[model samples]
Target: MTPTSIRPFPRWDDARAATLDEPGLLLYRSNLLGSDLRITNYGGGNTSAKIRQTDPLSGETVEVLWVKGSGGDVGSMKLDGFSTLYMDKLRDLKKLYRGLAHEDEMVGYLPHCTFNLNSRAASIDTPLHSSLPYAHVDHMHPDAVIAIAAMAHSEAITRQVFEGTVGWLPWLRPGYELGQRLAEYDAAHPGLRGIVLAGHGLFSWGDTAKSCYENTVDLIERAQGWLAQQREAKKVAVFGGPAVQALPEPERDATLARLLPVLRGLSNEGAPKLLHLNTSAEVMEFVNSADLAPLAALGTSCPDHFLRTKIRPLIVPEAVYTLAGAELRAALGGLLAAYRADYAAYYERCKRANSPALRDPNPVVILLPRIGMVTIAKDKATARIAGEFYVNAINVMREANAVDRYVGLPEQEAFDIEYWLLEEAKLQRMPKPKPLVGKVALITGGAGGIGQAIARRFLSEGACVVLADIDAEALQGVEAELAKAHGKDHVRGAVCNVTDEASVIAAFDRAALEFGGVDILVSNAGIASAAPIDETSLALWNKNQSILATGYFLVGREAFKVMKAQGSGGSIVMIASKNGMVASAQASAYCAAKAAEIQLSRSFALEGAPLGIRSNVVNPDAVIRGSKIWTGQWSAERAAANKVDEGDLEAFYRERSMLKRSVFPEDIAEATYFFAAEHLSAKSTGNILNVDAGNLAAFTR
Candidate 1:
């Protein structure tokens, strides 16, 4: 193996290091390493520095181990993310360590070693860092090093690659025992800089923070270079070369648009899961490879990888490429059943007396030969991260198989990690799911005030949203604003002319691709016009019907298709107007269109009831503020009809109401939210909620 051209270079600056204290330097090093995915995955590594600090209680200086805390991502973490423990107390923990069987108990003892009352919980990798002899330490799950570490001849390969600069240790579940073994190995090999933990990760150290960061990078670079050389020298085809060609981008996306909803539907049996699709060059190559099934069957080598992606992914059959509609769904259903059964059997085979109960049996990842990989999880970020972890696993396998046969962690070992009591406890401590968590909503007039308000409300409750509006510029701005306020993963924008069937379908497809499928549909796209029945032209009537009535129908119809395919109950909220149920003067076209919307919603409710789909209407009158309709000529038109100044229209509407109160987008949003939230109004369908400041004529009675 020879060095490759592309390698991670040290980014340490003496000036930067000089300004930062020892702890800050440690953070700097961790951030630098974590900034590159090629170095370490998100929350998949730990770093520490034994810094001299003045004890908060005692005035004396002491050594404190500042390490990446449990469940924190180094790249985005602040100073508070590090757990500080007394070095002397950590060393003293060896006395409490009875054996490997009781190693998990050591975690409880970590708080006792906490210095200065720092409450950040120490990670399981704490022992590995504290046990190292060096002042600075890093434990990283870099794909390159893990490639060597996961090889059948890992130890020999480590020796050959590093020429004794790096050492090797056989696979051990990370705990007190592994830490002790590391310390022993360091003592035996006086000059080694790091040790590659077989089937796990790499542990590197240095006398200084900079050196430790550099050493970690150097080792990973060396492994990457060696693998690159080996691949070149051996000239072995990756994943036994491509067995099938990838579909063209358009066709592939179309296939994904069709398949994702069905997959999401199947996965929603228990808790709903969001799906993420990856079609990067690497993913495309791997999924199209001849050895995809066999390599994927071997599972992931690193515990961090499988913990998110599961032990293995479900590979779609070749017939999937040829099937459509019911045939496609049936084939996928059968595949899912087999995958779940196999997972259940594996759980049974691996369960210990005290093991955690079986988890969701559905695979987190699904691979299609000519398309790409789809990862499903509770939310978008987790699903995306799961896909990334699998991609890293692919890289490891590609390189490892080039040099030597790759091996996954043993099945029993993988199960032990997956069902570990500590991991289970950590999960149990996570915050409860929000009311709308894992639900996806598509808003037809998402750029409008009502749509934006509803989106913000839904996002606050943890639902992913696809904002579809005919106004592309407004849609983009709203998408950006919402994404910034919520998160980029939770909001997406689609420029959709809801009146066009293809555009409406495309918007729903966007929703399916962005989230998994639509659980809630808000048909809010509308237009306002004021014309006497004698003066109303056919064009005005058609325009009003096209946007308000016809548009709602198209969007609602698409939503039903997706929801039905998902086999999950859905909620449809139509943003009709108070005029829908009342005769408004000189607004024949607008009132008629809104009336059509109300009737259409009731029809939908009747048809969808048996399928557990709910349809309801929110009637808001005189929403002059933040309304797109009011921003145009409709305001003057309404004011003229009411015989009031344009500026006094709001006051006029307020005075005209029975309650003399005004309506706003937020009020309408609240009403819509009630209908969409199943826990709030699961049994109340086909109902009309009036947010009209107490209008007598618009009353349902």
Candidate 2:
């Protein structure tokens, strides 16, 4: 088999390319590299071009590598695809890497002195790209060459195959070690065109872009020929008889359905496409062979790939796929039970005497009954990549074992790389701050002071807020105020009674329809009762509990259901009064209702945390002006009956707090914003924050 010819970019003249800015040139060059070299099919690699520009005042030239930007596919990168960095600043990272344990903070803390601040993340391996002395560097997993790397005598064979064209590496996990080793090898063997990593992929470089691209093609073509020859010469036996059995269409789909989620879970992404599978008798026979067990512990081709291709495959015997869903379920039950037990044994073996246990025991890849290998990636791209890599590794491991014992990275080293600082850095970059941004929030009783305040806060912080209230006029009035303060689109108004379940649910449904979904929930609606226990009527007791307690329950239940269904974590802020914590005279129903809301919030918090949702109770003290309880919207006679006067209310509320000041909704709003921000709250779950202007005295007033 002949390899694809490496194409030269006759059209891309560097003088013309350099006419663009550093970023523009970088994107163009990266795209050109991907296009010229067949290695990076479907955006499989990253490229960087380092340039030194003189500082006018100092008369000193500084080196900066314009790396590919995140989220920009190398295949279609543009001028914006690149981010410039001070090479001197980045090269300094080598020193920090040796002494510092947390590399991200050390690296991330370096501000963009020359580029836009809002630029997407620096390429994950910017240091490697920067550390290299080469003007042009390209990293890719060329499929043909990767196939060769999997061979047992791949290093010696590739040496004979490439004949001084590329350097060889024993596959260590990528990142720090790969970069360090490459640098060291390059120092020993200067001017090497590319590197051939065992059980992994290839890397190529040159003084010029064209040279690097051509060298890469040359190396891959040689490796490809070698692989084709080996495949042709090798005779593989099928364990089963000559005939292959195929699964029926319905059964196949049903089997796929069960496997898809497990695959997706392994891939750490949404469902990925199942490309063509090899289900021949020979393939099935190879899968069921005893050779698989020993190599199963070796993880994915790459650690990051695990989020795509999980560790190990589900090995199935030949007869399994012919069954119905129930039969498949039973088969899966038995298979998974054994798999988990094996995983536990593996986990225990892997664990040092005392360490945290593994979270997921299921294999990322699944070997189906008479179905070839299926990779679970978050998406099709990842799944295919994972599948290809796994298939390549298996082939290589076979060849290596045939020659001698095939050794892989130590389990501890694999674990370290899997949980490496670099991997953690990727996770930390976007920890889902402001997850509720651009989502709708509906707060009932939003016309009154506390409700109005909460509504306004949500609006100010980017949520499209609907302030629902029983009073039509008050709702319209508050809506107008919010519209005047926040833009018209930020606030919506609906007149609904908390006591009416139909009206409340209808309001929420309307908000969901208008705003796509409810991401943040602020359940702040409540009624107050002020009467001694002896004088408190059944009507009064029922009314307070109905709105303050039961209403919150109903709204909360709906919100939880909606959020959990959405699958993206949601946040619920239940505004329980400090009254729930401390007793006050003549307010039995209100106090009891508030206490119940607090407990409900706690339960929701515990349940939701696992699902990435959060429920927090905000104990707001003295957000009293226009409060339904204080404003007598329910009953003015009740306010007078409670002996709460209007004029001195602010002072009276302030006197109760340790700060001697009333807590405002704005303060609560800031706290809300913090929780919603992407970078704050490292592990804030089932937590209650008090927003009462230093009010520890819940009973003093």
Candidate 3:
């Protein structure tokens, strides 16, 4: 047996270490550190700590994982090399899988571990660590471990040695499966604090990094003993290899120093200092392996480990660092290209399968074949932590190799974990949009204020919006502007009479033919008759009913026919006025028609719910500048007719709402956009959104 000396790990001053007290900085450092570990040519490992606290009032115990980050190694670890996560929260997530049919509901929205809002992303092994019931968790893949795990009989051999001892998982890929499998196995065993993955590496945890590191060393010794026994029987070659070129400590130290502050900024409030550094021949040999093919396929030791160390390791060779600057630049370019392409493909397939998308795909860790594993970090502290994980993984794999091959999770499962909703929700929570993309929307009187706004917003959010109005000139104007902005293919204009079924049907048919489907119906064509009830004539009533009320019904019927036949749920937006809520003087017929439109929206909501169709209404008030109805207010004759002063007209409408301000067309547009975006209004069937500024009187009965 050979006696190998451990390298000295870097450290930070107390003041700098204090920076890691901050959860945000801790996560940043941990992520970079972990990434550096896996990516460093000679590095591939990660670090984590559990923060346990008793609630001041409830006295309930709370635990969180302050894990080292991804994208860096451990050699230059800093306080920032940690991500804080709620342990209890992660435990609760494990409970969901036990429930009945909660899969769909929990799909992308479910919590991975405890959700951490301040981290770049939760550690891939978050579940594994959280499930441990420990305060600290650290993982790594030492060169010794990698050598053994990568062997053909690794799995069978691993089983023979560690049977029923440390949990063994066949390679399942990385990310979700690694976390889930280890967690599941640990839960089943209840007492196991470590996992040996066949053809992979190892997982060790403790109350602190030191404890975990010690346990790691113990595991390494066991594997070394087993290997020594095998060698004695077979006279196997001993590891008396020639020294290889390594990353010069002076240069490495300087590079690491430059990275420390960034690590501090990511992990804690204070800077961090390194300690117990370990650079060995085993580490260098493993880093400079002749065949990196299998290493390239090996995923991170565990899922949550990805939060600390990314999916793949960074491979570095001897001359690789000689041209370090140039090589890194070239590698980054290649990685970016591969990443973007892979990500795009993954996103497209996931979208097709209704799956979530991952944040990024670049390998956080670089595994240079030689020159020692250089743990790159946003800062030095993180780089050190990453390097530590690399060492750990290497050690574990060496021991586990005597038993079995380290197996990872499957790719599909990995994607599921990468796109896990629970993790994503922590970043940003937004509602799903209405199901209407690539769907054509034909708005009657779309050139008017509300209609035009709806059209513009829909088009902006990936819908084919058609502006239809009785005023040909106005429709053309909107068409021209939208075409100029979004292109002619996206915005269309047509002249149609809502009162005539043939005209209404033809417009819908044209829209469908052009856009391949008519999924959204915006019924907003109407004439306002503000004459007093006593002065309201039968002719006026007929005109208003025919255009506003009957017109809406005709459009809705046509849209329904198109959407139902297409076998896709559709959406309809009815622009009802605030005037319809409470009565207004001299608006009897107009009020009756508007009231009917509002009810129509409610009915659509109910009927459409069963068919995946959503019906909603936007109640907007005081947005008249762009509305045809308000154009008359600015006319010379209108001023004379109303007997109001010119300057007072603008103020008059502005004072109508509680906000005492005129609503812009853009405001109404934004509201309409919500109705069309699947994220904002996915579950809003029969919903009515008020675009008016705080109209208590208008909102409620």
- Which is the leading candidate under lDDT? 1
> Which residue pairs collide, candidate 2?
24-79, 150-396, 152-400, 267-307, 267-308, 269-378, 314-367, 433-678, 434-676
Local error of candidate 2 at 647, Å? 59
Measured on C-alpha atoms, candidate 3 has an lDDT of 0.58
lDDT of model number 1: 0.91
Better-scoring candidate (TM-score), 1 or 2: 1
Stretches of candidate 2 above 4 Å error?
Answer: 1-25, 32-44, 54-61, 69-73, 76-81, 93-119, 176-178, 233-245, 248-299, 302-307, 325-327, 344-348, 351-357, 377-410, 431-701
User: How many pairs of residues collide in each model?
Assistant: 0, 9, 155
Task: Please identify model 3 stretches exceeding 4 Å from their true place.
Answer: 1-437, 633-646
Tell me how far candidate 3 lies from the true structure as C-alpha RMSD in angstroms.
20.6
- TM-score of candidate 1 relative to the true fold: 0.98
Output the better candidate (1/3) by lDDT. Answer: 1
- Per-residue lDDT of model 3, residues 1-701, tens digit only: 32353332223234554555434333443443344332223324566666665555467777666665444345555555545556666556655564423443433322344333545344445455555555555566644544455555665655554554556666654444457677777778876657766545677766544455556555555555556566556552222232344567566543332222222112211211111123466576565554343644565444444444554564533342344333444544454456446656755665425455545444345454433454433332344555565565554444334344444445555555566555566446434432443446788888887787778777766566778888888888888988898766567787899999888866765564344346678788876766767787999899889987899888888777655544456778888777778666667887888888889888878887887888888777766577777665224433444566765666666775688878777787777667766567878877777777767778754
Local distance difference test, each candidate? 0.91, 0.62, 0.58
Candidate 2 lDDT, 1-701, residue by residue in tens: 35344332325566766577655655665676566433554445788888777755467887767776654568777666677777776666666565323544545544543433436567556656766678888777665665556555678866777777678988765554457778888788876777877756777777766565556666666665665555446543322223344566555544553443222222222221222244444345446555555465554443333434455567765555545344644665677678778867766666644344464565556665435666532223344555555554554455444333445545565555545555555656754533334455777678877777666666655566778788899889889988888766557787777777777766765554333345567787776767778888888888878987888888877777656544556677788877788766677877888888888888888998887778877777767655566656424444354457656667766875688877776676666655544346536756677777775555423
**Model 1 misplacement above 4 A:** 1-10
